[model samples]
Target: MPVNTDPKLIAGNSNIPLADAIAKRMSMHRGQAVKPIDTRVERFNDGEIFVEVFENVRGEDMFIIQSTSNPANDNLMELLIMTDALRRSSAQRITAVIPYFGYARQDRRTKARTPISAKLVANLIAEAGVERVLTMDLHAAQIQGFFDLPVDNLYASPIFALDILHHFQDMEDVMVVSPDVGGVARARELAQRIKAPLSIVDKRREKAGEVAEMTVIGNVTGKRCIIVDDICDTAGTLCKAAEVLMDAGATEVHSYITHGVLSGPAVDRITNSVMKSLVITDSIEPTAAVQQCKNIRIVPTAPMFAQAILNIAGGMSVSSLFDNETLEPIYESLYPNS
Candidate 1:
């Protein structure tokens, strides 16, 4: 089914600021114009969830804005209930705009008889009556195949590339480094954008939560290295990669990730690492620790997401979202040389 524009934009408590920013980018006025529906998520005495859609949405196309980032379970439950509420209220169609899809890393069964949680989440969304899905920078691209419904997996590459070009004064000397072989495609895509050389970190995982840094695959010595990854969960991979790069004679190390799931000592690791800076998108809410981390910086993905929603609404090609010139003009118009 084709996505609809002008759908009633409903927001849960997950990431209201990002939703609001998307609203502004679409030129929708505050309050009634976009018909923002608020999902009142509450908890019962028995530890159950209760959700109420405060507005009527009968026969209207709906898009629920929520991110299953940190506190993934609570946010995921909120999205499920919102979808159910909209479906029950007789909405025409529903799309879950999940900017940071949690549990995406569990795309495969790594151990014996282990369940694929990513596939399970996909099933849950489909069962909730979501007609489609919109997400960005999933941990694994194959996860998209897990969804029965049509899924539009957006990219933060355009946004991240633009930021790198702007901030890194010596772009010509920058080398894009992938933290692992699994992310070679992602790294190459961005490296091509910035016209930088590409390298990979030949890392070995000794055990869960422990990484053994082996070697650098390409020549990164005496060049500024930028490690790229889809998500930064524990910062273990990135920090280890940075250390290896520095040891191999990299002049400086910087990093960019699409989603920053800074769990358990991630902030401390990055804060004390040899990295010059860590740039992440606002796909997930940053904790106070993330904010306090001196090396961390946030780049907004609101404009890109807003343009995508507007393009879908206007019967335009959302693939155009990846066109740098198409979106760059508007982004500059809004961000002003940013």
Candidate 2:
């Protein structure tokens, strides 16, 4: 289904590079009029966020492309203020296109007295007048249930599978590994696509930033292992998992992750770890430390993201793009003979 409404795309301070890429994709498909909206966001002297949408979006379908990544609180507030501004301007419908949903790790309270901050963020966005949300690879799938509005949860599996296929041919010995038992379902999906065996890392998390002991649950000895997960923050678990995988006789250890929230000591840990390399999507803009890391490589997600925005604008199925069997045909349509 082709789209009817012209998109008035807007971007916040969170991920400008990704926003620009999505806007450019829309422009190429729609025309010059579908350009990115001019907007300014800044902080006042009192440390308050100020947002101004310079264009007239009254009755226009507005999509704000922002990721709630690092500086989680600031970025989250910026998206909220931007949504409020568009609502006040009479935009037809507001869609929060968040690539990395921060605070999503707190979806459920493991303890009795802690707050479910993920649900709180959902409520805050709904109260901010956001009518719809489009995000990719949420920390937990149930976060969609928290929203009162339409939420589209996209995945990176298609891209990751395509990447794996392009790099490897005889995948007989390749293994898709889950860093923890909690991620086994995700690992199973990837393992099925590549027709590779699966492995699980059973580890006990004694605290937030510490991993007590990790044990490999499958036969990874002398085989290449690809550890998969949603987010790699601080690199504690990833680093430790790599160490154990190597100690268990795995020839090489690599990781494929959606969001790289490489906070304090993450880069340092990755650089000194036994992992061969880490491949992360460009959901969160690459930082200077990430760019300088010798063991880290980034796979561009702009093309897929651009196609997704175009699909949503056209009222088409965005989830189909994430299908294991549907990605390559679409990729060939976008960039043939590549």
* Candidate number with greatest TM-score: 2
TM-score of each: 0.94, 0.95
Cα lDDT over the full model 2:
0.86
Q: Residue pairs in steric clash, candidate 2?
A: 3-314
State the C-alpha lDDT per candidate.
Answer: 0.85, 0.86
Which 10-residue window of candidate 1 scores lowest in summed lDDT?
Answer: 27-36
What shift in Å separates residue 85 of candidate 1 from its native position after superposition?
A: 0.5
Q: Compared with the true structure, what per-residue lDDT tens digits does model 2 show for residues 1-338?
A: 22345667899988898888777766766666455688899999998999998889888778888899888899999999999999999888888999999999999999999999999999999999998898888999999999988999888777788877776666777899999999998889888888899999999988988988898998899889999999999999999999899989898898999999999999999999999899998899989999999999887676677777777777888877877556676566533432
| Tens digits of lDDT, candidate 1, 1-338 | 54445667888778888888787766642243543676677889986778888788887778888999878998999899989988999888888999999989888889999889999999999999998888999899999899988788898888888888778767877999998899999999999998999999988898767896568998887899989998988988888889999999999999999999989989999999999999999899888888888899998888888777766656677788887887687578544564
